[model samples]
Target: MKKFTYENITHAKELNIYLEQGNRVLGALGYTDHSGKHTAKVAMTAGKLLKKLGYDDHTVELARIAGYMHDLGNSINRASHAQTGALMAFQFLRSWGAPLEDIAIIISAIGQHDESNGTAVDPVSAALILADKSDVRRSRVRNTVPETFDKHDRVNYAALSSTLHVDVQKRIITLEVELDEGICFLMDYFEIFLQRLLMYKRAAEVLGLRFKMKANGSKIS
Candidate 1:
């Protein structure tokens, strides 16, 4: 087996451009934290999930990198961001000497991250989907003015804290969220995320884990 390291890539310029483009677009919409902060969290969480599940270190590292850049397609457009991001990631990974098989896995995972348009077809894809969708919290938008925060951002603002934990021993994936009603109601968050949560359920099923949720200390399904 060979190893592929993103550190050796000389395409930081292009990667930075992609990141900036996503930041700009999300900012224009007054979204709380769709940029690097959330993406970095997703990337790190994905790697952790794979690592805990006994995946190889190299594969875990690939998950980390894939999660970080999974939303690069949003730089072009939001409608089909995942699909476009897969192509972008594939091209860059190939240039970086990533093996063809690994490249395919990475690209597929990136393309299917959005539950609105994708399904978990592999372990990596399943892990990526769960990691990306689990990130929701009020800390992501504490800086945004209340008056300016839209419903999407307001839901994030209402979430005082959020954590996603995987219990490998119990084979359970749990999402715990603490919310503040002064900012937004819990129903608002569900209204936006129920579909995504359904996708997470499918992703968890692929990993043979039960998906559970606890919001404000109350069990949600």
Candidate 2:
């Protein structure tokens, strides 16, 4: 078993600052789950899923890195933040002496992470899509106090819990959300997330798997 390590010094400290600053900015804008914990979870999940699918270590690491830094563009603005994030990541990685090809992959992945602004340009993009979409849940909003809970947050907050499981042998990727109907119903949740879920299905197709969503013990898809 080989461990992955990058020679970049800035990744250790500067990435921390980016994550912190992103959290502060999103908190101000009433968005939840753009913080360290969220990004870390996404990174780990993306890497593990790719690794389980038998991708090379470099690919998995790229997926992890892309997942971690995907939301940094939100620091500047919500719209087209993915493109801004890609440029930011490209400059930082280049400064730290990361290879240009790898930097390109990372930047492309970051730039296309948003469903509205993104497309699956590579396997990394597919992995990132799975990781990002799997993060919808109630616990994500447990700490942040939004001024007005919109459909996005309300459906997410209504989830009592959620789990994303990738079954390698079965070629199955399941997103299960335990819901509390007092806050929002399944319809409301689907109304907000259905499109993203479709994107997740396409992402899963790229990974040769099925994307299944189970809400309150019922299979919705």
Estimate the TM-score of every prediction.
0.91, 0.89
Best by lDDT: 1
Candidate 1 global lDDT? 0.82
Q: Write the per-residue lDDT of candidate 2 for residues 55-152, one digit (tens) a residue.
A: 99999988988888888887788888889889888877777677788888889989888888566667898888888877877767744554578877
lDDT of each: 0.82, 0.80
Q: Give per-residue CA lDDT, model 1, range 1-221, as digits (tens).
A: 03456443313677868877977776675556676688778888988998898888888877888888888887888879899999998888877677888898899999988878898988888888988887877766645567877687788877778888889999999989898988788898899888998998999898889999998899997
Model 1: runs farther than 4 Å from truth? Answer: 1-3, 6-11
Model 2: residues with Cα > 4 Å off, grouped in runs: 1-11, 142-148
Q: How much is 114 displaced in model 1, in angstroms?
A: 0.7
Counted clashes in each candidate structure: 1, 0
